[model samples]
Target: MIVVLLAFTLASFWALIAWKGMQERALAFAKAGSETQGLTHSLAQHASKSFNAVALALFGAGQYILHSDKSARASAEINDLLAQYAKNIPQVREIGVLAENGDWMFSSFETVPAVNNGDRDYFRYHRDHPEDETPRISEPLTSRVTGRPTLLMTQRLSNPDGSFGGVIFAAIDLAYFRSFYAEFEADLNRTVTLMKTNGKVLVHRRDDQVGKDMTGTALFSGRLKDAGTGLYSIVSPFDGRTKQFAYERLSDFPIVISVAVAEDTILDGWRGDRRFDLLLGAAISTILIGLAVVLALQTRKRSVMARMLRERERGYRLLAENVEDVVTRIDMDGRRLYVSPSIEKLLGWSADEIIRESAYSNIHPAHRELIKGLIGQLGAQNRTATCEYMTRRRDGNYVWVEAQLNFVQDPDEPTAEIVGAIRDISKRKAAEEQLVAANEQLKALSETDPLTGLANRRRFDRMFDAEFKRCQRSGSQLSVLFIDIDKFKSFNDTYGHSAGDDCIRQVAGALASCLKRPADLVARYGGEEFAVLLPETAAINAEVVAEAARNAVHDLAIQHHGSPDGSVTISVGVAGGKCDARNSTSSMLAAADGALYLAKEQGRNRVCVAAENPSLTLVRPAG
Candidate 1:
């Protein structure tokens, strides 16, 4: 019977250890997956924004080629414009326009090459499909001039009659992406990849794996097709190691960004813990079996057994005193019976000093009730309870802590005690707070214009739509002010782009200062243009605000050699009315635009108001 009981006890202990090991393994993987997913999301956003900027440059060049005179197509002005586009976008290696027959007409490069791209896949596709006006991203290929690996972003240029004219393309160096991805590879077992949805790799941590086809893999054909983002584990075909992967698809482009860490790398800590637990369990099991045998054989040697038990008790007490976490023994009434010496290191209190005080005395006033409730649960259920709360240290500073309480009852006595462990969790709490702050900062950056420091066009449109609906429901008046810097293009041509940027920033700051009300929103609408949304304001009140903004910009006195006023100035247009089924945000925008055109027409540095009718009303001019 003794042998059977000992065997059953050992089996139960090992079973519990196995269960805990499984839980720890799962938790380790979960943590790695979550971190990888977040990294993939950030990388995807960066790629999308880079591609979008390049596409915008291509579109702008296409528009210029289509509208400009044929004689000026290959002139120095066009070359300068292309070079400027390339200079502004860091991801773009070159910008050029090709003739109808694929001859290089002009380029941003310092020395124009005589390369003909008529046979290139992107050029052929645009020439073959005249109706497809969307931008095309080509597969990776070597550039004809620079001989570098490049991805071409092309938009088709058309003649006046809608026939294929040529392709205006931007060459993006693959090394740019490879360099960006290399920064994230902090671990030897971690990898980052940027690839097309069709499975052709553009850039990989392993340079030799570039251009490998992955369409046969489950990631491209199954998981990616079903969702835009996901996390999974698979054996990498390039390197036969099992990896946990997190991937995100770019919203505006056919690109996938993936972050992977080796499965062994993620589970290394778990495996170590499992080994330690197994050894500890085996040691305890062997001791138990030996004690049972001794009891069966040497029943008369009971005093020696008692002495061994007392020594074991002393060992346990020594361990409790040395651990970093504070250990305490308390009565059911929350009186501290014993306190560990580690309390002095954790909370600046000696063990003897803490034992004299009630357990709830050190807890913050707001958190005292929480600690009391957790203790109550342990007493009633005779189980463990855990809670987090703020406690006052001896220095009068509050620190965050996590406390776990376990109910202990002696079978031979009628009294019960509570064993508690208190660990300082201030660093973890601080990290959680910093994460929330970073999220808020990211949100703000997404909605703000980088150059002018005002709300971006995307944010303006969202707020405008919401304000329109709200005012429509409340029957309040809604107003809009469309403002433009007078002769901005001439200013750019006279003082250069850098000076022009400074002029815009100053004007934006002045406009922001004039609006005193909290509900007013001034946003950078586009290049050299600004818009203001005024809720619960009539057209007359809007004109007043518009005039104030105009004067504020004029007060900056930024010298513009190309302007008639000899200083920077703005033209303002005001439109306002009750929003209903008949009145829409688009109509209000159109009215404001027309009024702004009239203001520019009747001379710059003045304010104009648009009536409900098509006629424009002139307001007072700025000084």
Candidate 2:
């Protein structure tokens, strides 16, 4: 029975070691898959956008030629334009223009006899099917100019009456794109294939593979039939190895691009790790068996107990050293008894240094008392607590950390210790602070007028409510100045809305300049109207400030064609009352409005005052 038990233990250890090795193999495969899929998608998007831009440029050139006079005198200039583009565009071997009858009319390379292309797939498709306005991509074929393998991009040209004129085509060399594919990180077994949606190969790393029919392939029948981009695996018919494939479709065009990576390439390193773990596990099993036999023969309980304790301590230390968060144990007197080796990475301090210098003393001064209260609470009760605070690092900079603590109790011992794990949360704290500041900026923007850059009505109401409540206690006075730009509507209609906006801005600036105190506020009440707030001013003093505002506007001397005075000006109505229990902000606003109406009735561009007894009178003009 003892021998069988030992054998069972050995088998279990081997199985556990094998499982660990399998996990590493899985991770390696996933890493390869993720990297390949990511790069494949990125390059596909880049290629699609580039091709679309090229197509647009060609379309523009075709449109220009169609509208130009198709005379023999323009032929040289036209062919010269084509030759220049052929030199400028990368990967383009030549450019051609086909007549309406499918006869090649012009070539960028040399003067050649007219060659009929009526049998060509791209030319015949454009001629037969007129509704497909998109650029057609042709299968790989020998270039009619250079005799090199090439892919074609062709677009339909329309006559003046919207009839089919001809086809404008660009022969792009396959060799250029094939060389570009080599820049990617791919092994010998890997493949980059570009084909049409109909599963006709247009370009491939293997030159001979071009123009092959791949419709019945697993990639086309299973993965491409369902999604535009994804992963698929297949056993290579050539090498008999399973290969993982990532594919991306050119969304703007009917082209599918795929990349294949062999599975053996991904798992090459994992096989070595498996062999090493198996041998190590077998050796460990033998040592364990020998230790058990020796302990049994010696029959020493103290030695066995000591060995078990050492093994348990080593297990704990191994677990602690592997993690990033530091584990700590502190005494009731605020001394750190132990800290994991991770402290060196977290705070640039070794565990020994932290224990000798004291952990709590290095906390930020503002947070030290908060941490002490939390620790005291943990000791006073049997509970776990959590906190986030700043801790000073060895470089004298503070880093934010989130700590979860537990009060560890022992039945064999009288004293207790606090055990905790501390994780760096500096990034999270910074994100939180940025979120708060962004919210504040958005709030300010919502309450401000965009045109005049002054406080809007929403901000004015809140300030008025708060100031009204404060004045109810102090029994101080409050004033409201209602201002209106005289003939503003006529001004906009005469000089245009642009000039009207400038007028409003200038007037608002003049009114805001009259208020000297920070507590005072000027807000855009609405179109062509503004309001000023004076916190502790009586009616007489507010009238003086209102006259000053009137003078400031007159001094601007902005010409207004509609105004009889021939200059932009403002009319002000000042109203003041004690903000006691009897008065409200709305009541004061009504008084100011009534005064403003009376001022307009008396004359434009003058200041009027609303007294405490609700009487209106004109204030003398300021110099």
Candidate 3:
């Protein structure tokens, strides 16, 4: 039995370790891919910035030459410089020089005559500005010469005497930037395009739009300004493929450069990483299964050896199998490494399943944090912890289990483990709750009179002590009523003891039912005598309840076994104090008893109060 348990435990531990390792490896692979893409994006952004700087520098240099030397010979020299530089820089396709009268001084095109620039917005914008040396970048406009999408950069020139000259304009070649970026071999599906601020496709990697207008395409226009230079997802303008893209705008220029890569390209290496993890997991699983089988065979061999030696192998096996409690083993890391067969019956989960899941996960949420803290304490040399917690079941119900944990270091492994037992104590807990309820019910019965189900003498005495202390502390008032059956003895003699018992029961019930507050209690003192205790009550109010009780009992007609008339009545003697310091419960009872004697002396059926000197007079009921 020991050998089999050890084998199952080792297999389960190895499986959990393998699972955690695979998950970590997958995360590492994903992080590596993101870092690689970041490097590429950083490089592309720098290259785009370099290109924009080169274009602006060339335009600024050309405008300077035209303004510094103003003669026709110098003008021809400057125009020649512009045409020659345009050919040298691959991105600068066309450059033109215009005089103050709007006649073209030079051009790169072969058959072009002197061009008029006075009507152009670029020319007028530069010419009207007086001292601003900054150049103007025009929104995309159609070029009559090339018929492709184009942006114009105009730099204002000045005469040698600081007077304004015409503008020197240049049209940057977008096709050149697109063609250069498309030649890269990193990802073939990546699309590169240059677009103008007016949502016109200036150039695309497809190369077929050299003279076409692409203003109406959705690819040319969307919400680009809101999402500044970063990764985004949209349909590709060059190939209509949905993809992830990164874009960067040219500083001090009107063009936006974008690079689009398909989703397949971004996740290119993910499948290989997943496959490698699966292979490792499968290999571990096979090794565990083989080890489990070998251990099972060894356990059987050991059992047979024990039988041959006449040892008690069956007894040991039966003891492990039929145990009534759950036994579990946890490693120093607080992971459940082993669980006994009793767990299967108690929690509806097999030992192997419990071992595979987190020990904290199986505990109810209310107990999970507490168990984690206990495990932390155990790790810090508090080697044992005993607690009762709830464990959630497979069907979503929870059961209480009392766990006893102890620490032991395995000789074969470096880490210590907690070996524990969990016993189902749900039945015990329910019995404890029932016992508590029954105790409370018995306490309530102890404070009540059996005959009238009202507060008894003992209850009245307790309440009086409490009320007296409160009144003394708060300077409040209290009252009491001493009541007696006016002719109870004669009635009992005429009607017999059973009728007397009925009369007492009837009178007590009426008095108790008439009192409203929890502080008001009516108790049967002895045969034919009753009392009412009223807290925070004055003498007059106490007399009111006493008189009401007297009348209620007088109206009672209890069936008598031996009486000539089947009836019962009571007389009350009320006494209270803002209760005077001289007055005690015994003194009050004696005075009320004196009033009762007066009522009896006058006639039966009347309530009376005692004044000074112990004189008693009958008090009539109020209308």
Candidate 4:
């Protein structure tokens, strides 16, 4: 019966520990899944922004160069503009502008024939649906000019009188993303995928699959439609293997990015860890069983028990007095029947004084109730327990101590005395707290931008995602502003790059200062461009913010001989929309980018808000 009871207790304890370890392992996997999703989402976010920027820049260049002039001079200007855009973007094979009749009027390439594109889906979509002015992104198709498979993006070109003039098209090479995945997945048990919202797969690294239609798959019809980002475990229909998927639905572009790792790979170490824990528990239990038998046999030698008990009592008392730990004995009523001399050294209280004073009164008030509860159980038959608590010291300070206790029957009396030992663990506890503080500080530093001493781009992305999610639930509006230091390249050319960096720092500081709301975030979006994300803000309020940021930079009055203003000034674009299921942050950024471009065109150092989606007409000159 004793053996059965012992085995059961050990098994229960081991099971509890095993369950806790499993929870930790599961939490680790969950964190890894989130990181994987973030990796893929980041890549997609950068690529999408690059595409938007290149498209807008090219369109702006075309309009500025070809306004009312289809002459050779204007064609030359368009060629130059496209050259600049294409040089920066490696994925673009060709950029072209078409006339209203769908005839290619100019190409970025040096010598190219004027081809007709009236039958193209992108061109036809813009001509038929002029109201939907957003950039039309099409699936991969063979390009007539480049003769290579490409993904096309087009924006409608309007004349000065607000009439439809033509369409500007840029063909992005699909192999660029495919090659990127090849490099991104190096020797890891991972697959990177890029697919359109229509369930058309553009690139899938593992199977070398491209342009596969996956509209019938549960992955798209189920979780992908609702969640912006999530982790899922399912058996792949294509490969018939269980895989963990970390997927993100891009907010602005109708695209989804997925990173998949096999279920076996993710759980490889956890199973081994569980097995090791079980084996360790078994070994300890076996040792404990052997020790228990020896102790029980020794306890049955009744003839010499009294003599041995006396010798052991003396030896225990001597050892207790010499040790740093304080030993104590209490009766069932909770009175201190015996106190070790070590109490004076450990707690700054004499044994006689501890016995005379209120028993256990020096325990911290916050922990007194817990100690009382534990003390009540000291009357249980031979049951041992351990707990840690903070106790008041002689100097009115608190010290942490770990206490181990058991109830022992008194030979001369009917009652049992609770024997206990208390060890100082204050140093260990302090070290743990210090380690936690250091980790928090390191994490904060990693998220902070060193140059401007503000939240960096990575941190901004995280905050934007979280706040956007919150606004969606609360039915609130989110406003975003894109700011750029006008004529920054000329600033670097006139002054050195060092001076240019100072100008950027000054601009970042000014932009941050203009924001009064705690929910507003300003981050350096690489180089001279900065972004301010405002949560729960309306268009009116955001307009005020954008104008303020522009003036703030102008107020700096930093000299720039190359700029028309002869001083550093910024162009700000503002866009506002409800952060809900129907809208994405990227759309807001695109609108703001268009507005900022308008500000630059209307004249540098101005603020413009989106007149409507995909266009900015109203301009508020910088004050």
Candidate 5:
């Protein structure tokens, strides 16, 4: 029995501990994952900004080199200055000046012929797009002469008379960019690569990829081009690990900068955390096992005489201390004979002070007589009693308790006594009450429009169904006004979706405010449409309300850009009363829809009531 008890205790205790530990670990992992993604996004933004800054500085230096040489004597001086500038700007490799007919007049490298670069694509691209004021950064195109990976930067030049005569073209070294990017990143394994929009690898941190064709590869295939700029995770061909990669299109340039970090690099911290948790678990298990062994050995030597008595006392003490519920024993006279240690925990009173006192005195005065009657019922039938009772704490505050009592004979004495367990149910009761309130609030929110704070489509549907049946049973009136905004689609197309949402919110607010009674329901029927259920209103009164809605919307006079009419308006349609003997719900909706079409067909911005207009019968007339 002792071994069985020990096994049970160990299994239950460790199960609880392990469950909580695993929960904490799962939460830690989720938090770490969110932080890692955030960090990667921040790094991507920084890379794009760096690319823009470098491109701008290189273009400025090249422009200064091209414009300084206006005469032959100054040509030699300008060539020397251009060479110094190219060396100073680490990202710039070669600078050259080209005429309109694609003739390169000046070259940064003296050995290269000036005529060699005349007919390149850079000069032709500038000539095609003459109106673009910004500097043109060409897509990564391989140079025919150098046969090295390069990007071209061309800025148009004006002669003294402001005529477009020539352009300054620069050949930027892609390797220099890779080195500059390497200095900015701390992770050695992280790869940074530059590529053209056309899927050619211009420069990779690895030297072998300088002139490689990367078209079929997933990274350059279309993912980066389609996304334009953002982060992506892809399987790396080089190492097979999932790489968290991000890319950005350089401003005024067709090239994209990509940064890829390995998955293991981000998970490094989580791995350390798991190791620390395992060490802590091992230490705790060792301590618990040692304590269990000592307890078992002590139990064997006591021989069950004194041990039984001590255990009984310990059991009672533990029940009082560990269990949050109150335990008490009472005499036939209803006097408290004993109370557990938790009496102090629950009521702020020591056991000594409460022993021998009338237990009913602790209960609230309003509940004392009711509890006495319940106890009488328990004794008459030899059955237990369970009830909820409010008791006064020593602090004079009230708490809710659920109590169960039954008669028992005291082992110390043969006299009968009532032993009872009372649990503090205040927190549970409060939670139940809060849960009920929250459910009700959630039900309300589900039926309400979050923007206009009006009844949403769900509420409108329910109200319409109920009101339609009520009108049918009573043979009374039920009017539904379907109001649509005039030229709402054109307004959204012209201004913006945000302004369209604002317009809907404003109109719904106006419709709700104009409602005079609680029985009148105004709802956002669908996108730009609104509905009002006016029970007991005839077609004439429904027309008045529809006209009021139309005028109310017109008075708003909300400015819209796309409409040739240039002002906001609402076209309203009203159909009311149980005219047909059958009065089907479908027929009522058709009537309202027919009226709305007439309102729109009559050049919009007007109210039309189908039930009142005898000339225009319902297209699908009431059955």
Candidate 6:
């Protein structure tokens, strides 16, 4: 019976060790999955931004060709414009404009090469599907001129009659993406892949695998088919090793990014832990067997207890010394009874010094009360309390740290003590701040026009709605100005598209300079048209500002032979009133638009004011 009992105890010990080993294995894989997901997300963002920049260049070049003289298609100005775009955007290798027949019209290359992309997939697709104006990203292909692997981002250009005009494309070197991915490849078995949604790999760390077809793989048929982003495990065909993968699809482009790590690599630490646990269980089994044999010996039992106590103390000391966070014990009087040696590494304060001072001394003055409140909760409710606050280090700099406090009761003592663990969380705090700043920058970019540096139409509409509601609530006056550059299309025809862009920029600057109040908003309402919102301004004031803006543009003295004034000029229309149930934003816009039509009819380069009724108007004569 004694032997059976001893055997049963040994079996249970081994069983418990096995359970813990299983848990550790699961935890290892979970951690790997989380890391892969984060990496994939970051890679997707990078790829999306890079592709968007290329698309912007393509769009600008296409618009320029659509509006400019066809005779200047091969001019030096076109080449210089494309070259400037390539120089500014690091990802783009070259920018080119192709004719409807796939002949290269202009390129950023110093020497123009006679290359025909008539056989290219992007060109053929755009030609065949004339209505599809969305930008197309082609599979990896060798460039005709450079002979380097490149991905083409192409957008179809359209004529005034909506017919297919041509295709404008930007070449992005595959090596650019490969180099960026190389930074994240710290291990040999780790891989980063950028591929098309159709399974053709565009860029890969393994050059040989680039352009490989993966459509039949489980990653495409099972995981990606179900969702845009996901995690899965698969046996790699390259090395026949099982790998865990996380993938994310670009939000604005038809591209996918994947990060993978070998399963064996992820579980290496778990395997080591399992071996150590087996040795520990064997030693404990032997000790139990010997104790069972000497069951009647009480003297040996006392010695065994002493040895076990010493072993436990050694194990605890090792754990405390090796842990990254500081382990601490505090008495009821808020004094540190013990502090782990890691405190020195975390805060530049020695363990002995920390124990000598009050526990709250290093905490920031503003955060001291917060920590005290958490401590009170731990003592009063016998519960755990977690808090994050700034703590001053011995070097006189404050670092963010998180602390978890728990009440620990000693059976033999009258009072309970607090056990706490503190970890330096400065990196996490910094990351949070950076995320907030990025979000603000993204918002700003979304609301502003890239060319003129003024608010875009979307921003104007939003502000219009907000201000309209505010005027209705407060009974304050709201005014709007609709301004147009006279004969802007003829101006573009007189000067090239490049000069037209310059004129628009100059006019935008002059108009912006005329507004003085913080509540005023100037936006590029559309092509050659600008809108201004003036809150708390009356109709007369709006007309005055509009006249100043018209005069401001005339003062620019930019040569515009298309205008009767013999130079660049503007026509302004002003509308203002208190918004009511009947007078809405749309109504205000219509009234302003009518006045603008009248200003142009009476002749260009003047301001027109509209009454509360949208049809009734008065024109301010041109100076």
Model 6 stretches astray by more than 4 angstroms: 1-11, 70-74, 287-296, 299-623
On a 0 to 100 scale, what is the lDDT of residue 597 in model 6? 79
Arrange candidates by lDDT, descending.
Answer: 1, 6, 2, 4, 5, 3
Tens-place lDDT per residue, model 4, 1-623, is 55776778787778766786879588768866876777877877866765666566555554564443768877777776676567656777777888888898767788655688888888877777767666767896888876877788888877777677788878777777778777766634777888898988877764445778888887688787677778788787557788887778777778888887777777777778878877888798888788768766775575487687678689778888888889988776668866899888778878987875455678888988888788787654647889889987777888999999887886766788778898999999999999999999999998888787878878888888888899999999988888889999989999999999888889888888777668889998778888889999987789877876775687677999988888999988888888877777777777887788887888988888784434453333454
Q: State each model's CA lDDT, in order.
A: 0.88, 0.81, 0.68, 0.78, 0.72, 0.86
Give TM-scores for every candidate, taking all chains together and pairing residue i with residue i. Answer: 0.55, 0.53, 0.40, 0.52, 0.41, 0.53
Question: Model 5 TM-score?
Answer: 0.41
Measured by lDDT, the strongest candidate is 1
| C-alpha-based local distance difference test score of model 3 | 0.68
Per-residue alpha-carbon lDDT of candidate 3 for residues 149-217, written as tens digits (9 for 90 to 100)? 666667777776777766667777665666666675245465666666556566566657543454564
Candidate 5 residues 291-338, lDDT tens each? 777867876665675677677668677766667787888877788977
How well is each residue in 1-623 modelled by candidate 2, as lDDT tens digits? 44677788888787778777878888887887888788788768856865674585466458657756868867766777677668766767777888889887766766844678778888878887778767877877876556687788999887878788889888877776688787774563567777788888876767677888878887678778788998868775334678888889888988888878888887888888888888888789889899768756666775787797678668767887789999988877778977899999999998988886556789998999899988888855557999999999999999999999999886645788888899999999999999999999999999999999999999998998888788778989989899999999999899999999998999989888777789999999999999998988888989978986886787778998787778998888888889976678887887888788777877889887778435553332243
What value of lDDT does candidate 4 attain over all alpha carbons? 0.78
Q: Which stretches of candidate 3 lie over 4 Å from their true place?
A: 1-70, 108-112, 117-121, 124-133, 138-151, 158-164, 185-188, 208-227, 235-240, 299-623
Off by over 4 Å in 2: 1-12, 110-113, 185-188, 237-240, 297-623
Error of 6 at 30 (Å): 0.6
In candidate 4, where is summed lDDT lowest over 10 consecutive residues? 611-620
> Candidate 4, which segments miss by more than 4 Å at Cα?
1-5, 13-21, 66-68, 206-208, 300-623
In Å, residue 367's CA in model 1 sits off its true spot by 12
Best by TM-score: 1
lDDT of 1 at 27: 90
Better of 1 and 3 by TM-score: 1
